[model samples]
Target: MTSSTPSSPLLPAFGVGTFRLKDQVAIDSVRNALDLGYRAIDTAQIYGNEAAVGQAIADSGVPRGELFITTKVWTEHLAGDKLIPSLKDSLTKLRTDHVDLTLIHWPSPGGAVPVAEFMGALAEARALGLTRQIGVSNFNIALLREAIAAVGAGAIATHQIELHPYLQNHAVAEFARSQGIHTTSYMTLAYGKVLADPVVQAIAQAHGATPAQVALAWALQLGYAVIPSSTQRDHLASNLKARQLRLSDTDLAQIAALDRGERLVNPEGLAPAWD
Candidate 1:
């Protein structure tokens, strides 16, 4: 776990993601993950599974203090007046008083909302005990700079982005590093695409591990926190073991050569200009 500052919330290196999951599927996935020793969970307002995730958490009987819960505010809620209120609404759905981390889901749908306005409101949310820390997702270099200007560098705890072997996103990752902001690599497995790569498969064979574990270990070795999602209990349990699958320099290099800038999360209007 790491944080940009002393007061920043501690973010675990691995967690379960609830992106496309919903209803009973989300509940079962989250419950299975928690039961398999996963202590962190990532969800967002747009995911439409916050309440299900909340229910899974309650049913697991995991103490709130031992878990790190993260949720994101959608683009519609980026306005200064709406940010905090929407987060409160998210809190209600999550069944928690405060989230470990809260991120702006995207950069205000083409910057219609100024970074300062929402960042200030998010900081206010942290100050008011609604969230322990604040961060952003899908922000590019320019947008990250604007956010850093709105709140000091240390205030932005983590930058969640679409990163994996195919789309390494070195520039944004480097910039985040220079600012001391932790990077969360969403889609770290490239949504199962990379799991079939010959290079990844070879590495998996050499390590005697699953391809999913190899991909996750690569991201973990690069210092990025990963929240890989899986509905199957076997996959969830297997993915958690990635933390222990250390990659050698040669293995890392083999996977690094697989980078081809193949991004998979770009949307028509919501995605920003990528770095």
Candidate 2:
């Protein structure tokens, strides 16, 4: 609920991610999330549910200025000519003039499109008021370097990645921090895998919080923004409460020991060489 500065457009520390959600399910999930005090929502063109998300936002009756919405452009549309048009289509589907933040969903497969082309196009999108801020997802240290070269680090608002206890991705996160680009942790729960981990479960018990809350609190404590998705109303409400669950240094260290570099979202041909 903080204000965005000219330099760093604020991304809420916590938000709801709509990845595979679709149709009425997506709409209901978003509506429930909004009703539960979630002001930030994350979606993407590949998710195929922007319209539902937009409709939910519209039906929520929340003022546009009161919410933060982020969406990504798929890799196929990374070309300079396609980027803005795709974003315009996304805006039309999203029922907004501009999203708070927009991102390159992933690096082009086999380097089909250079980072410079898309990054520059993304900057153009911002200049044209299609989006208020620009960023990249699934980018490694090297890819981030290329993005920075395309558009100075100051122009990039955030670098979202799959960060969790199992796959800390410290190298990428550390480098991004050095550049002053915020990191958003997508799939912070490891798609529910971490929710059953004994270490996370134990920490949750000690704090009287759920394992999901422990994982989210751990990411937040590390200065990373998290977008955890869920369809169940109770789960969504409980996850939002993670903002209030502060983990102790001991708890953090214990969770840190659980890292195994277990990445769960790498797709063949689309993922970059990870750090």
Candidate 3:
């Protein structure tokens, strides 16, 4: 079913997440999401789905400005020369002149180019008009501070990180809030684990929502943008209601108490000291 939301410069806080989807699958999934009223689509270099995501965008008939597309440069490609080229390649794949936002996938330490250099290249890309907004993903409090110190807040916009009821992330969330930095909560549903949690289910029953909606609502209430992925049309359709589900103060606290700092995809070899 197609859907849309009231206009808010702040993103919908609910979007499509394409992480493990492959070529043809990504394309089909994206088209489905678009037809279903999802204006925001998230992709990354590591996801191996840019080409498919691009294809879907190309055929969706959605105005470029209307759709908020986000793509990222992999940690391995954070070098000076690689930065622009990688972005160019992503643009080529997405079939767009520019993306809504381009992010540094990881703050790899001692890889090749310094974070400052990568951030500089990102700023240059923004100036070049290849990307409207530039930001970072998988960044922690220290890296957030480093990026702020190096590039300033005006350049780096949001920090995309793993946040869910199971991983409260209050520290980073509060810090970003104070810095006027918005957060995009990837894995907002805890990769489907939240779907099975008795607590989440109970909360969902109380609000007449799915468990995913409850978890997503928890993060949204905490002021973090959420992107919950679902290959199933039913789940995707139900997830949109997450934005409308407003949990109470006590409910929010109960969810926050579930934090265990669990991580889903670190790949420390790709980013040493990733924790």
Candidate 4:
């Protein structure tokens, strides 16, 4: 959000999302992202492309410290015994000693394990220097409260979540802001659906930016860091330009009016919304 926030200091306002890209494609995307001035890279073990991401980061020759690298530990491996190993696997695949940030992929709502367990484990990993910062993803306010209480001092460095104008997560976002925790916004593009929205297209025409950039600009303006994924050269190039698209107050209000509570990436079996 502000320049003083945790997420703000670690990366630029926008970056690249590499969730589904894999093998040579993923590797190529990472390299291309670096070349395009994308200082942040979001990846996760569940994505199955850590090695490809790692290879590209290594070859890009961009100093490791300059690039903000992120990876996540899947919910399946959050058990005390499996946590470290999972993080190790991530490190190995990422070709880095430590990641700028690491997140819990999901809370595994219907699963038996407690949130305290993994959040505690994530704090421990942070203490052990496996990651510069640690947090959770796909967790609503209740889960976030649990995560915050569980981790205590290492209290979530950030909360990666599915946030778009449609699914305005105001309460949790407000809570995060109050506590000085940051949010990592995934699926900010509505998984390509924004490309077809008439309102977005109209706004794009007015701003002379693609719908993709308009969507990203809206999210970034609201203070959540964004990661939009793209495989094509032109899409990636245009997506990065979102950082430069500044919307006026009226434009922002139009986007705010566009919210219809449409959530595109809800994890099945999670608790109800944090109203």
Better of 2 and 4 by lDDT: 2
Candidate 2: count the clashes.
0
For candidate 4, write residues 1-275 as lDDT tens digits.
Answer: 22224355654567788988989999988899888888889999999999999999999999998988889888789898788889989999999989988898887657567888887788788889999888788877777778878876246777888888677777778888777788878888777877888888889999899998998888887888999888887888999889899888787888778778787775557544645
lDDT of 1 by residue, 65-154 (tens): 999999999999989999999999999999999999999999888679999999999999999999998999999999999999999989
Off by over 4 Å in 3: 1-10, 272-275
Q: Residue 245 lDDT in model 3?
A: 89
TM-score per candidate: 0.96, 0.96, 0.93, 0.92
Which runs of model 2 end up more than 4 angstroms from their true locations?
A: 1-9
**Candidate 4 regions off by >4 Å?**
1-7, 270-275
Q: How does residue 85 of candidate 1 score in lDDT?
A: 93
Candidate 4: 10-residue stretch with minimal lDDT:
1-10
- Ordering by lDDT: 2, 1, 4, 3
Model 1 poorest ten-residue lDDT run: 1-10
lDDT of 2 by residue, 33-77 (tens): 999999999999999999999999999999999999999999989
6, model 2: CA deviation in Å? 16
* Model 3 agreement with the true structure over 58-133: per-residue lDDT tens digits: 8989999898989999877788778989999999989999998898988875546677888888988998999988
User: What are the RMSD figures for all models against the true structure?
Assistant: 2.7, 3.1, 4.1, 2.4
Worst 10 residues of 2 by lDDT: 1-10
Candidate 1 residue pairs in backbone clash: none
* Top candidate by lDDT: 2
